[model samples]
Target: MDVQKTEIWDTKMVPRMSQFRAFQQVLDRTHSHWDLKNSNDDHYTAEVRRHTVNDFVFTELAADPLTGNRTISDIRQSDHHYFCLLYLEAGDGVLRQGPNESKAAAGSIALWDSTRPAFFGTHSQFHQFSLLIPHEVALQSLPGIEDLCGLNVDGNEGTGALLLSHLRQLHDTIDTIDTQDRPAILRATVDLMAAAFRPSEEKIGGTAFRRALLTRVQEHIIENLGEPDLGPQNIAAAFCFSPRYLHRLFNQFDMTVSDWIKRSRLFRSRSDMETPYLDGLSITQIAMKNGFKDSSHFSRVFKQEFSMSPRAYRNQAHNLRLS
Candidate 1:
């Protein structure tokens, strides 16, 4: 099979600098005493004595990939950073604000939002792994996720340990992961990562429900590509989703769900034209039967897509077969 990219920046740094700039942003704020190393083709680390000294280290480590570099305040109120998705492979401490103290250690995941000031201080040396996903991707995995920004993913045991183990595996093997498994791994990471941060039973069930619902929609789309009634409302009602949330899923793919339905239908129609056994069916009849109300519109769209009308496409295929 032709290779798909699953390139790792840690494993390939010379040309990967551009690819890894965004990942580097998560470590922006290391205190002055922290050892520093920045080079084009080198593995870098941002180590510190505690997880909760300050949150400013993130933007400094990042510089500026999406938003401006977050500045370190002289008299910081938050022992933690303003905005971050914090994960630790190993460490221990208590992050404090007012009367609440969030436990920090290995197997822990916590989200800090810059939108609100917060604090979490690791009492001792901390080992950290983190990411600065775009605000858009963040919301995709956790709709209305802003509500849980300051909350810590409880990590004493169970699913939290499972997620922590996965992170450890990812960190250890970031050097050598197969390319084809990359997308699935990334998606699984997003699912488990979100799970680590929220412990509410209701929230977990909700995430699972959405994931299952989307999977079913995908199955329906593939199975009934020719039925035009497969429009947004029917889909939304079938899956018990609001059309708005349905749009969000399509938005992730840079398509309107309706547009994808039409595109899929047209592709299937064109494929049908090439079948010699179906020669008894005229191209116009095939188009009309496969969800096209206006054959002229179908012709225009098909020609624009394939650079030939449906009839020409069939003729070209037929000639190629006889030759």
Candidate 2:
């Protein structure tokens, strides 16, 4: 995306005595109020890289040991509230908000809310990436987000590992992505975060986790729709779950695994039939391209889905375009 980036503050750019003030001013303009503390006055060094991807913001920070707080006064002065997800790349820290508190280490993630009071402290040199997601946008994917505040999600296993891995890759390749693709990428990022923070199976009966896993599975199915062997058993194996459990997961949405795949293939073929450029391909070819081995069966399902044969739908689309 060749994401537009700004080096908001670099202690090396200013005198030693003015470094802290410069850092504070930069924080005031970019983030909410934060009271910063450092042990060594002469050795303090810090740098911040800010990148805006659509409505979300990513800040990469590297600095010496320090402690900071977003006090009650700071929350009162802020205009917009945000939910920040911190991905720790190095060092360790402790975060506290309300009555919740946690000790975070490398490869862990912490959630912070700007609408409430919070405290964060780093015990040594640190490097981390922070994703500042607006409260409204975050609430869309994570309705129970408030429960996640002041907690550290272990990013070394399960869905948390997947989310952190995706974020790290995004950070490394943000420059190569096209601007038009940023919004969708950011949306997926939020989805992963929501999935990672889902409550334990004992608490919510694994409903949220299942939803997240289903979304990932559906995306994988779409990407591999051209493969003739893509089916329920294989899909379950891909995600390291049992075939019976996979079927149960789909049942939550009142769908059978095979039925869902058939519907997806039918929809793709139908859309292609309506496109002018794809008019050159025969009905059998289109069906085969979308994983339907039997053209007659594909036609029957298409009629049932769209209330017309594929050929009729394509011809009607062509006539409409001509008119």
Candidate 3:
């Protein structure tokens, strides 16, 4: 995606007083309502950069202090059922939905449902990244999402920290990432959020927690596959989980942590080898590229998993393409 084409709205393009109206117009198009508290023309400024990938929408918004609402009346006016996960990059705010209210500070995240009446107010200049997932799509991953509405997840520790870090990275690289990869990245983001919100042992039970943790760990491994030191201990430390606990989480998957990493590396290597664009690359080069320090060990694992050498697999792919 072109970086310049990524921005959908900017206050700089409009006059001072019209800034709020322009922002509202963009919000209307997305089936939401905004009520700007600071009606003073001199004080209003805003910008939104939106990137839509499949059913998810990643938006970066910067603006002066203001209040917004998604009410039952508003919902009737425009019925686009969605769930928003807002991560604050700067400033502070409060969100209220039904009986729950939470304060959101920089590095913190808040979840809100569009089908319910909700209100959020920014108290100062603010910058935020919001991931809008369709209600149906989010429900598929997080069945108990209703229990999380208006809840604030602290992004400084635990799965929340990992979720925040991954979101920031995605926001930073969304434009540069291949169009084919965006959907997978967005799906992973949703999975991480579902995990981040269900931290209570009693609420999600032990099994559910383990599954979410496994998903997060797998995502971390895939993202860092190129790092030679990417292992259970380092990955555990990254998410503030103990090495023993990390291994325990993978037990239910019937695979050890090391086994999963090796499998993932081999899978990626096979994918690259099958690509005609990389056909000219040597097997050893492909092995190292996929984080295999020793080509001999990679070859051993590849043949064990696929019953064929990497070179043989590539040759078969070439022959099939030629035919």
Candidate 4:
């Protein structure tokens, strides 16, 4: 619940000659240590309002034209390990992390990892919201988060739009929200951010990239197992891959996409059948809930997979629990 506001640089307080140095000191204290260059030293103006909500830090920054670079030395000397999610609210800029360089226009979000070197610059005056997410928390939500640095999350469409709206609302209401509720709200924001980032078409690189992407796709399928219309075509479309390419990706694991979906659904259904809390639901209800359309077909597949009828399995589970 701690909030800190810093007027990073003011033309009147700090003379033109000493403005850059004073700004650098403020930047070091308020944000990450960056090798900063003033694009408009003659007209320097910047301010920052920072709020610490549990493990996350939400910052609002407005500044004149400038560029900040995190060099190798800066990375090595700094102990900060976090991911920065920067949303440009008023102006555009170019952000570079690793070999990836992307344009971050207004209403767009860009991610950068603190452990790596990066470059950020704005051509004109800009206002932005930057959320500093601890590394462990970020990785827990999106294991492939590092790959997202230097990529743009389009805030105008889909989940990105939702995330943008959430961020703006959070910015407006953070002060009024109760301290106990801040953590939950921040966690939900992170989840929405992960969802927004995941659907973007990641660059298909070498073996490591492919392996990570495949794992992500599998995780996505597992999460959506109950969707009746979940199939290779839709899955492929969701991940921005062609159906044929998706099939090829699954083929590498000696599993077909349809078979994987069916097996996942069957296993999920079996688990639900055995759960005591789900006992009130009938067998056919459980089957259809896990994406099976016909009761007879669900029975045949249940037997094929678990060697038992769904009803018999549920009964056995209930008896075992009683014993």
Candidate 5:
């Protein structure tokens, strides 16, 4: 992330979270469970740049506290073991910080810069939503925050909550962020975040339509996977595409209309087979749901692809799931 260039991605959803967890190395962040008791990995990636440092803040409140007793997972960067504003927001519960412990409930904010270390303790399950923004982004306006660096901003009201509300909204709508509108959204959000620190907003740029269009297309496919009529022609019609033009799109993936839909149905059926939630769905029923017409044909195709009959596989899955 070159501070000179502008790039904003909302890597803030469960799918992105799984990807980040799978590839924490991209984050280049480090974490330390440098306090008392039970131990675990100090580092984990929360997003591309932002990291979550679990109990590091809480350790300040108490080495031992009243609660279910918690463990801190350092969600942070490998570079800059220290940061200016180590902010945290709670999805729920009472979080103790500084001289007074406050409940962040929902839509609340807490700020902590590196200089004066802050500690926190949460009652019940201490799940935290945190961000490690760049020092440049944090200290943009409140240079005096050097003195107030580690102090908690009363994010329960006014500017802080407003900023938090924005963060929460972005976090919630991440998967649905339209690429066509992303540049505008990223620009506005960056400016809004900058302004929250009461700093002059940074000049953000726009996105190219080509990339945005591709994103829009992928989103369409993912959202409509279950539509039995979601063949290339159907999709093309929905997108106002000519059949020939739609065939060109599938050609990129080296498949024609029918093959693509068949493979897609197989994949969805395979995914469902892994879950007990589909226990009531007979193999034929599941296949029919995904557009397969005949149970015997469905079984043969499934067995060839997965090395097992659909019922045998479903039974195995159910047994394993039970275990």
Candidate 6:
């Protein structure tokens, strides 16, 4: 079969009486090598939306129940090898990789590797989000992360909850993010996964632990950016870490915690300023809404960051939209 690079948002729907051949063909192109089978070949229905996000591919699929297998030969035939993180938005399934097997329910996340043979069986019609991460990048982000393959992380509470929320927000606000920030977002995703699946015996001072902590801190800053008290001190207090340690963590990423908060607020404010639905609000209101206490300060920083005043940027964006 010929393979080509997928589009940014490629949507494919199964048609009638093809015996699921088309479904399998598209799946192989968008995903990895797989031999698929379903009880309803004549009437099997599936919709797949594959979206590209920087180095990762985020795919949303809604389909009738099916089972798939990848054997050693299948793996060798596939051109791409990577780690897949799957979130079951609405489905139940079982995934087997190596000697590990996991039962997946709605709101559960599972990790698996494409280099290994695996089997997946779904119990009912379902919706899912599959994130494909490059193999080298995954290993670099969290050494030994492959050990967690075939394990499901419960999305109801603890670190799992935070990871789930981050993924959802990433999807919802993807269009608002700047091109330069996309890499950071991808890195944070890996860190969050490591945090959720790191072994219980891992040391707190480990590299993965530090990266995970940094991700958590960055998320906290994002969630509380609108608060007047959102600064290093308050953030450290919330995380039960010393302010010095927070600074040290950010330093490792070549960023200052306070600067990141300001940058995040600025980026959010800029996105709002460009949106048509927010046109009624003045530039000052937009700045304040994004944690800017002083309009003049906000204007100064906005111009420095984007080489234009917020009002000018909004006007330009509006003109482009009208054109």
Number of the predicted model whose TM-score against the real structure is largest: 2
Per lDDT, the best of the predicted structures is 2
Cα-based lDDT for every prediction: 0.54, 0.80, 0.79, 0.79, 0.46, 0.79
Point out where model 6 deviates above 4 Å.
Answer: 1-15, 202-323
lDDT tens digits by residue: candidate 6, 1-323: 11113433222333478737877877887888798999975676788777776558777788889999999988877755689988888879899988789998988888999989999999999888888887756754554566678888888999999988888887677667887777788888988887787655453334756767776777777788788668999999999989999988866445687887887888789778767889899999998888999999999999997778888999987896677
Record all residue pairs in model 2 with backbone atoms less than 3 Å apart, i.e. clashing: 1-177
Q: Tell me which of candidates 2 and 6 scores higher on TM-score.
A: 2
- Give a tens-digit lDDT track for model 3, residues 1-323: 21223447778888876787777787666436655466466646877877765546778888888888776677766535688988888899999998789999999989998878888898899998887887756754664577679998889999999999988898788778887787778788888998898647665456755766776777788888988878988999999979999877766435688987887888789878868788788999988888899999999999997778888888887895677
Residue-by-residue lDDT tens digits, candidate 4, 195-276: 8876334343337567677778888988888788999989999999799988877675557889878877886787687677
The TM-score, computed over Cα atoms with residue i paired to residue i, of candidate 4 is 0.60
The residue ranges of model 4 lying beyond 4 angstroms of the native Cα positions read 1-12, 199-323
Instruction: Give the TM-score of each candidate.
Output: 0.42, 0.62, 0.60, 0.60, 0.34, 0.60
Task: Report the C-alpha lDDT of model 2 over 126-243, residue by residue, as the tens digit.
Answer: 9989888877567546644676789988888999899889989988887688888877888888888988886565644556567678768877888888788889889999999999
lDDT value, candidate 5, whole model: 0.46
Residue 100 alpha-carbon offset, candidate 4, angstroms: 1.7
Cα-lDDT of candidate 2? 0.80
C-alpha RMSD of each candidate structure in angstroms? 14.2, 13.5, 13.5, 14.6, 18.1, 12.8
Model 2: residues >4 Å from true position, as ranges?
1-5, 201-323
Candidate 6 residue pairs in clash (backbone atoms < 3 Å): none
Error of 1 at 224 (Å): 13
lDDT digits (tens) for residues 16-122 of candidate 1:
44433434432333321111123433333332221221111221121111112222342232232233556765566554333334666666766655434345444
